[model samples]
Target chain A: MMKTSKIPILKLYNNLLISIQWELDDKTAMQFQEDLLKKIHETGATGVVIDLTSVDVIDSFIAKILGDCVNMSKLMGATVVLTGIQPAVAITLIELGIELEDIHTALDLEKGLELLKELED
Target chain B: MSLKISGIVEFIRMHRDEIMKDWIDRFNKADAQSISAESDQIDQAIAAEYVNILIEWSKNKEDEFSRKIHEFSKRIVQLDWPMDKIAQCLHTFEKILFAKLLEKQIPGDPLELLSEIEKVTSPVNREVFLQYTSSYERTINLQKMALQELSAPLIPVFDSITVMPLIGTIDTDRAKRIMENLLKGVVKYRSEVVLIDITGVPVVDTMVAHHIIQAAEAVRLVGAKSLLVGIRPEIAQTIVNLGIDLSQITTKNTLQKGIEAALEMTNRKIVSMGERR
Candidate 1:
């Protein structure tokens, strides 16, 4: 049996916050995607902020999953904001040719919430 | 053969002063302007050192000969002596030595005597040339480092606004550096907008434009907006003519205008105060 740990997602008011504190393997990233959508459904959240401050290396597959999660959450009526992307990761993603063009981004969780609030208004 | 070789060395040692005079006179005549600015005493001292190293080599003092040659070459390099002039100086000394040996009619084959003279002089020539090129390479490497340091600099001008002024041709290496600095500066300064000023860039070909676009995209990914500023008229013409799409990035004609736009994005403005009464 393969051991897989679930990334914790916290709910604050109508917003769901997920801070990835470690490197995410493909399995965990997919599991987080599903869990996030289900949590948004259960809590009826209108916004999501995914903080990737602690996550260092991201391959193309993980980037694609993150982009997909954003689009999927948008279809379910909750806006998603990716926050705290490291400079190295950003350069890597750009080099990998993944722009994540439609996804909203913020510098940190605080700004991510502000962006979410601005989107709501 | 051994006696003949020692005889040639003995012959060179016996007429050392004559060889020195002839070598110095020939060197000064060949490139008078190169050494004219320097005091004649320093020039004579360097020439004497050269002759002494050659004498030591002919005497079979290999250790002292190498040490003296190394120090002499370094000094010559520091004095900014041209390599060709040094080569000519060594050639003149060899010629003078051969002439003196032939005039005395030393008991040896002319070819053997000439080859012996060449053996003593050629090593010094090679060492000096090696030192000259290595010193030049050191200087070029230092200047390259200095240029890299000046290539990318991010200045945080106002709250939530930073400025990176690029001042040279954007090669792929420099472009990579600019992108890294722009992103790190944005995150460190918590800047919402960054203005990349390229006023000093001389040319903007397709490759440069592509690098700039990639940098701007990476900045966006790091959650900061990048504004391309300082677009001179020619750069604008090239950018448009190349059919590069810079529509995604906000651009301004000057850094001043870009700063204003950055202020607005951060929900601020510069209000001018009237003159004091």
Candidate 2:
């Protein structure tokens, strides 16, 4: 396994906080998706906050994977909130026709935690 | 070539007064209203100085001639003289000078004389016209910048709520500005809801609708809800007629309702003081 393929997912109370600080390749993103699902199942986390504050570029493929990850997390009884989406990345994703419409978004991790809490209630 | 040019210049010097008197006469006849006492004085001085400048230019003093012409053009443009007036004035001077030379029967090819006159005078005319156009373009750009600054203003009405009142036709450029201002204000104000009040927007075409939708989407991505307000009756009809999909965006008919919706989203409401003593 490539060293870069594994991104650490930290558990915080009933929520999983994953901050992606670097660019993600296909394998790493796929690995992240599986690891997040497994973690969610094992911890029985009710909320997930995926922070993309430091991740600058998100192409259509990654946007699609994110949207799918949010959907999959929902299916497994976990509410996923995407946080810290940069302004340029948002514009790029929208330009690429990936609205990520069904996902919840917050300005930062604290707000993302609040949103996740709201969804759980 | 030097001898011939000097001869021409000497001949012009001898009849400078007569040529200038006739040139002013022709100019006043063409545009009599422009002949004010101050301007007439300036024109007369310029007419005499122009002859001296050309004489120097004929001596191959090209640098002096170019600098002098540039200064003259800047002055003339500041006086707001129309380009045609300047051209006609120069043409009048040329006609009078040529008539004088012709009457003197100077032994030379008239074509060569004409070409020599063109070489010196064309630069002056070109410089004046160029200066006029550049000054005019500068004024227009300044006004455009002022108008653009006045067009979009984002006002944070309450905590976590900002209002941007757009008052004009929504073009692609203005829409882009609106989006930028909205996003920046949202981040700055930590606004959870942004109300874009377009009551003054005169039209809602397909392109305009698309820009608005895109702005709303961007606002959403930045974690702020974009609420479009002040959709007039005609604007509503146009959006529907154009089949523009604004279903994803939350819109209200008036800013009041939009503010209510925004306040509601941010978990706030205005309460009236009930009969305070």
Candidate 3:
């Protein structure tokens, strides 16, 4: 079940807006990282935005997965954008000591969609 | 054919106990009041009357079978069954015996006896079930206990051995762990001083204070002084309540101040004079 990673990619011009609906727990995060990386490499998308509205908790391992996904996308020539990060999530992220300096997070999904539209040009 | 009563009496005596024991068990245990200490006299009186009736009914004891049936009926009134099984056997025998004698006037209920048997057997089954559940609960409890024991962490020890004790809610388990880790840190580093910064620790009770004291003692044994940093006002209040003495140990409010104290102990102070302040 954890092998199935939800990386729904939509291409608009040069950019790809991916909505990750799958639960990115420790077990499934690696698969997601691999899947997103492979998709970005294959499609040659200039920019990517990930929607995280459904996700409730992001532990150390998942955070590390996110870190790797961002770094790998950089190598593949794309900017990774995160969306829908709640206040509680921010507190948990800080307590867990996950360095989210490199990845860009928007307030809501609408901002993420707008950013994707802007990045396409 | 000449009928002899003595031959009948002997045969009746042999099977008398087997038949009578069942009736008596059901009679007494069928209701709580039947066998209670308060109703003993009443039960004896009823039994005596039953014995007389049985004797009167079997007055014509010429046949061995008839005489034996009489004695069996008398024994049942006395509650002489060893177990429910023996009682059951007697009830079955009574049924057959009454049928054979063409005594339809006598009322014996096989259904009621069967119900009684089920009631008697149910407690044994319940006892077995209780035992199984208790064992299951104990196993689950033991697994949780084992998990807790295994998950107690090993704190990281540095080369310089700077113990940053963020001490709030120093429970017994944590206290013991802190003590052990601090001592381990002291010996492992072979350093002169350990900077224990309790900046985030809000409360320190007697037990928690004692743990810190023990850790300090262990550090001193390894020829190291533990400089505890960040004495919060709340912690100070708690310590005063317990009447503990912190006169010997060095304490400071900030990590920088603690560092300065350790430096002064070694007579190595950083002379950073501000330019034209």
* Ranking of predictions according to DockQ: 1, 2, 3
Question: What is the per-residue lDDT of model 2 for residues A1-121, given as tens digits with 9 covering 90 to 100?
Answer: 6675588999999999999989988888988999999999999998999999898899888888888999999999999988888777877777777888978888889888988878778
Candidate 3 residue pairs that clash? B8-B64, B12-B68, B20-B76
Pairs of colliding residues, candidate 1: none
Model number with the top lDDT: 1
Those runs of model 1 whose alpha carbons end farther than 4 Å from true positions after fitting are B1-8, B32-40, B58-65, B107-114, B274-277
The alpha-carbon RMSD over the true interface for every model, in angstroms, is 0.6, 1.3, 20.2
Write model 3 residue lDDT over A61-111, tens digit each, in one string.
877778788888989998877766543444456545564654665544565
Docking class of 2: medium
> Can you give the DockQ of every candidate in the order shown?
0.84, 0.65, 0.01
Residue B158 local lDDT, model 3: 39
The alpha-carbon lDDT assigned to residue B111 of candidate 2 equals 85
**Deviation (Å) of A21 in candidate 1:** 1.6
Error of 1 at B79 (Å): 1.4
lDDT at residue B147 of model 2 (Cα atoms): 83
TM-score of 3: 0.31
